[model samples]
Target: MTRFSANLGFLWQDRPLPDAIRAAKAAGFDAVECHWPYATAPGEVVAALAETGLPILGLNTRRGDIEAGENGLSALVGREDEARAAIDEALAYAAHVKAANVHVMAGFAQGQAAHRRFVAALRYACDQEAKRGISILIEPLNHYDAPGYFLATTDQAAEIIAEVGAPNLKLMFDCYHVQLMEGDLTHRLERLRPIIGHIQFAGVPDRGPPDAGEVSYAHVFKAIERLGYKAPLGAEYKPGGPTDDTLAWMAAYRP
Candidate 1:
């Protein structure tokens, strides 16, 4: 069976944050991930991990306006200091959670300076994270979802990762966003799987649980496994209702 990581930030969100970690563990998930344990301190996140015994597969630097807007930090044009701060905070958080990867989102806005700054800031984070055994993930949010962002494709992210040339710096493979931005999922995954430090999903079109969504997770997960992907398949999606109810799709595939 494909190993799965559920994002507790979306599941059991109504409860106190740490309890969400326990909830994902209770759901039989192999790991728990989050976009932001923002208000939740590193001590708290680490404590939750200890109590639940769930590995934190990954997490992202704060985008700042996810509740009011959708543009992420890496989407910005010339705010390298901001990126550094965000990455530093996330790195500390990653350390506490013992997470392996931190997804970097370029802030949304257009300017050559932004691109340069983004790269410079990324290199800084990459250097620091390397010492801590964490891989810094550079994710390309789809243009529709984050217009004006500097990097918006796997190819672009690959270029930056190559330039940075750090073993700890890599791209995040988000199946839903990439499928929405560009198609040919399996072939693409095969082509870029090497630099991919993480993976995620949501059904295409509706971005719901895989059972009702457009992407054939059965096919996708099979392809991923065939490619020898060894990391958790990060379940980063909005719940259809509550977390457990949304995960009922996993039942149909029971062994």
Candidate 2:
């Protein structure tokens, strides 16, 4: 069966994280994911999840100094300690929330120095989280949307994962970014299946609802199921209007 997770990061931005979890549950999401949830108390998040009976799929490491325009901490060349701390913080929060995965964000950086830092951070993260049984994920953002980001392609991420050589490390494959950056979505999915830990989607270019996207989600979802992907697909898109208004597409794929 194909399951969906409401991305509380973009959806229900008007509400608090706990309230957003409730909103996702009310809207019939099978699971929930968030971009960052450090501001919300883990107990409150746990309470919401308990009440709603919806599991949190995952959460992301902090993007350092957002006011300074830093997108993440992991790959920045001189910030190894800060990046490792961010990983620890994310893992700690995920432990409290019982989230299965944590995305270690690779902030804006480039070249060999940035790659070395990213691999080192992942090594530390993987070693620490192995005891907790939580998976560490790396996602490649599209350059158009995330200019100058260090990780900008699926192949780059795959190579990093291989170089890191951690069993707990995996890929967070976002279909929206993949479609925009590299159009061979199904082929990439198949090739990266062994390392893919999660999947997400939104409309290409517009970043809206998935049903009207340039890529056909119907075929994509079917391919995912046929490939034996058991994880819930994260709906990581901006709503066209109110969050609820963009959910008509859910009726078709979500039971």
Best by lDDT: 2
The best candidate in terms of TM-score: 2
Give the lDDT of residue 167 in candidate 2: 90
Candidate 2 ranges beyond 4 A from true positions: none
lDDT values of the candidates? 0.80, 0.92
What is the RMSD of candidate 2? 0.9
User: Tens digit of lDDT per residue, candidate 2, span 134-237?
Assistant: 99999999989999999988999999999999999999999998888888999999999999999999988799998885788888999999899998999999
Deviation in angstroms for 95 in model 2? Answer: 0.3
RMSD of each: 1.9, 0.9
